[model samples]
Target: MTTVTTRTVTYQADALTMVGHLALPAGSDRRPAVLIGPEGVGLSDVERRRAEALAELGYVALAFDLHGGRYLSDPEEMLARCMPLLADPDRMRGIGHAALDVLRAEPRADLDRVAAIGYGTGGAIALELGRDGVNLRAIGTVNGLTTGRPGEAARIRCPVWAGVGSEDPIMPPAQRQAFTAELQAAGVDWRLAVYGGALHAFHHPPVDHTALPGVGYHPRHAQRAWRDIVGLLAECLPVAE
Candidate 1:
């Protein structure tokens, strides 16, 4: 059994109430915590499963919601709601910082080893947290984009691992190449895992991309992404229990 805590906290100065699921190791003290940002559909079963998996792995995982009860049932709807947020460039960063603050406030959380992982929009937020110097040990993103211009990469202060789909239409080859160049120029320690044939939301099980024929799921990529994320987290903050 896991000793996990659940609650809703206000982020962005009460502008948003984010429901968070925190999983802690049994009898563990000051364990590292990951501030997770859910995918476009917000906090769904996939994220919850990931949180529980992390908990089982002996790290405190905090899954925070950005979508607040409303979720998209289709790609069009998802894009309608997510596009503006991604375009803004600063909203995710602000929300990420706020969420990190909330996580740091937890008595059982080890603020020193704090890190972040975001999917899609959430991934961009994690990058922003690192870019803005949130004192993160490491960060990772799944199907996340880098919206800011080239020069902004210089601000990132933590190691980053980005899992991208080889055929993701939104984040195409050119964009990924540009993103990689920016990271290199900034001198940030980073790794890119390019999975073949996986679409944008590879890990989201309920996401059916039949409507968008080009989008399909690759189970291998999904499993590898999880492994890479778990490994990164464990390396940054080990299970001392």
Candidate 2:
């Protein structure tokens, strides 16, 4: 196993103090960087481990926070906080940019070679960054096919890859069609993968707390989605050994 180091970082956004986790590979040479966003439930061990995994793969990674470092275990609270934030693209951009700044601040981060990947609400933020014309090598989202203003999507220069469960009630076929149509109209390079028999948040591991309906964990699909995400990163933002 490759040696990696991680630390807790705190930054401010939207008048709230956000705590994020940063992970780096063993060496000092600058490497491509990846920004990870957590699901609507907020940043937890899942995202932190992802950052660590990316670091092991030789990319500087940061798992950014949502809800100001608070994890929403309550379904009502998660929806109440995420629904409004998701509805406001500007707000999502604010969160994404703030985390990007943190990632860029790292000495080993190659600003010119960066990618943004998110799950759930975090995924929406990644898409928003692309819409905001952020120069990303690639963008990956899981169960986060939320649509944005078409005009803004035209500004996205990087390739986008999204994955969702076929049975996801939150992002059903119609919603998926609308999202792809927006991307197609904008002429953005994009791809979508639907995992059969998987539900929303399938990438996430089983949780002890209660979750809303239509959300569950699928270990097998989760592994497959991670491989796809890594493949996208490798294709778009290869890290030299």
Question: Candidate 1 vs. truth: CA RMSD?
Answer: 2.3
Per-residue lDDT for 74 in model 1? 79
lDDT (tens digit, per residue) of candidate 2 on 42-133 = 99999999999999999999999998889999888888999999999999999999999999999999999999999999999999999999
TM-score per model over all chains? 0.90, 0.98
Shift of residue 185 alpha carbon in model 1, Å: 0.5
Residue 199 miss distance in model 2 (angstroms):
0.5
**Segments in model 1 whose C-alpha atoms lie over 4 Å from true places:** 1-14, 208-213
Residue 19 lDDT, candidate 1, scale 0-100: 66
RMSD of each: 2.3, 1.0
- After the best TM-score superposition of candidate 2, give how far the Cα of residue 68 lies from its true spot, in angstroms: 1.2
Model 1, position 202: C-alpha lDDT score: 75
Q: Model 2 compared with the native: what TM-score?
A: 0.98
